[model samples]
Target: MAGPWITEHEVSVVEDAMRNGWYEHAYDYCEKFQAEFAVYHDRQYGLMTPNCTTAIHLLLAGLGVGPGDEVILPECTWIASGAGVTYQGATPVFADIDPNHWCIDPESVEKLISPKTKAMIVVDLFGNMPDMDALQAVADKHGIFLIEDSAEALGSVYKGTRAGKFGIGSVFSFHRTKTLTCGEGGMLLLDDKELYERCSMLRDHGRRPGGPAYFNEEVTFKYMPFNVQAALAYAQFQRIDELVGKKQEQLNQYREKLSDIDDLQLNPEPEGGINGAWISAVVFGKSHNMSKHKAIEELEKLDIPARPFFYPLSSLPAYGEMIDEYKTRNSIAYDISERGINLPGAANLTGEQIDKVCDGIHRILT
Candidate 1:
């Protein structure tokens, strides 16, 4: 059988939910899922949304981050992080990342903060949490909001605190590829009761305190998820610990097999921190100058599926004019973007299959 990533259990649960009319109960499922997720993260509140992007927008909107305000984000992340700021009419000020961990550098972030800066959207890249201690100090000193984009770090920890619990508000993705799969869904976790209430109203089309159609209110975008997705998400959340354990096992196996290879550099986990290990990444050494296209082709030829890391947010046309100014000087993110590749990282791969995948990389690089 092919080495597919999704588990049989996940498939079964999703199918059962679909057959039981769970999708139609999206609103109820969302409420339940939100409560469960918040409890899991030890957060005060949680809101389930259609996707992570919308969750981000909702957070920014709730925070009142709009025109004339600047939001700091790492230049190395996916465009979606920057897009959320743009959607709210906030200027995105790109900052450099810590080359070793591939997360935003707190020192660099401090250099970029200006009078107009309103928030810092710190991303936990590749499941590695940013240096939260440093970032928290900066946000506190400046009186600015900190938003944790924990889309890739659902189970990751920094200084013994979970990812979602660190920021004023945080967003998590439950997409097909995450450690926990919900098909397509997201959640926003926050501690502030007022912010949570605002997010709920905004997500539900600006519904007032009363029931539907009883009171009129300002227009707001509808970004609620269907109950079916929430049902699946809730089910997945119940098994999160098991899923994370399998992912950790897989990561250990990959590290054991490939750590000694001279031409490849594996993703590094923070000291004394637990990473989600959602995706295992490898970067070609400087001597190889191996382009992502060539590396991907070699892996494909060996029946191993690998993908390049996301293009730098600065490289996209939507933010082209700001690229030159925002590109961090001498950051490894540039090199990582060109040479980094994501290995198959779903939770269901068998030990033998993982060996085959590693063996293919060893054969190509050695």
Candidate 2:
């Protein structure tokens, strides 16, 4: 009745882990989960962290990104993307996104690259993997590190390669809203062995040889997740295929059912990628004559949960002036942010519930 978003299987797994006192097995569970996730995405290594933000921070630090360095990111993504760069004392250069796919535009990325540009974080926003080949070319040309923030793209694939496998380092989130939910967890995947070793040491408090118990050998922070969370994450990973399959089916249903509405526009899968369908998004076309905020309010009144898209980082107070000079103004990223809305995309939503949500939008718009 409350329109639950979490799967019943996930709940059961967590409960069982708690009851059986198996939470202490988190380290072992996380190790296996990381290995499985790496193999699933065809990556060489995977390191689990507390959340995606921390994972991104680890990757940035591991790559030696620091003050005077710049990391390129889309202006339209969650603040965490930009915050990760800032956490490393590296300036985040906001780039506009592709109007069609809502992911960072490769051309825009190239134009923003400078001598200070040290890395680029290409996010697979809304489960859609961007043009990695094109982005990779830009990064390669500039000799900058590329970190794929696959937080919303756990199961997404581009050009026959998985999203997490594209860059030198990548991160994934297991938040409740993601396709894969561990309540609160994240992972860092990388190809370089030395980077992985450094990330592990950093996550564990920089514990070095001569340091005290559980202390770091190098300068690091305690970003590790307890074993309890790791057990739940491992159990969730076991059902990832099932969960992703259900979300994809739900996306197809939404696409078909909402097709008749002329004013509503649905996001399509990328040209050569398979989306995880992490969240189903729809935009009111120019003809809708309704603001995104109004639509969200109307949907909420009808008990159909819908949320407005993320605000561009350039508009935020903390980094507003800094990013304003990055060519993000008057960009497609701003346009998409204003127009987009995320519909309830939980795997547990039944067909009737989805129909109710669609009907609510139709009623408000038409």
Report how far off residue 57 is in candidate 2 (Å): 0.3
Which residue runs of candidate 2 sit more than 4 Å off their true CA positions?
1-26, 208-215, 321-330
Candidate 1, residue 96: the lDDT equals 78
Question: Across residues 1-366, which tens digit of lDDT does each residue of candidate 1 receive?
Answer: 112245566567567657764454536667788998998889999988888989999999999999999999987887777788899988998777776777888998999899999999999987878899999999999999999999988778877888888879999988877887677888899989998888888887788534678454768978888777887787778788887787778778888999777767676767878888777777788777687888899989999888887666776687864556655552555667788888888666779889999999888776
Q: Highest lDDT: give the candidate number.
A: 1
- lDDT (Cα) of model 1: 0.81
TM-score of 2: 0.91
lDDT per model, in order? 0.81, 0.80
Q: lDDT (0-100) at residue 87 of candidate 1? A: 93
lDDT of 2 by residue, 172-235 (tens): 9888677776778899988888888878788887864235795446767778875667777777
How far out, in Å, is residue 70 in model 1?
1.1
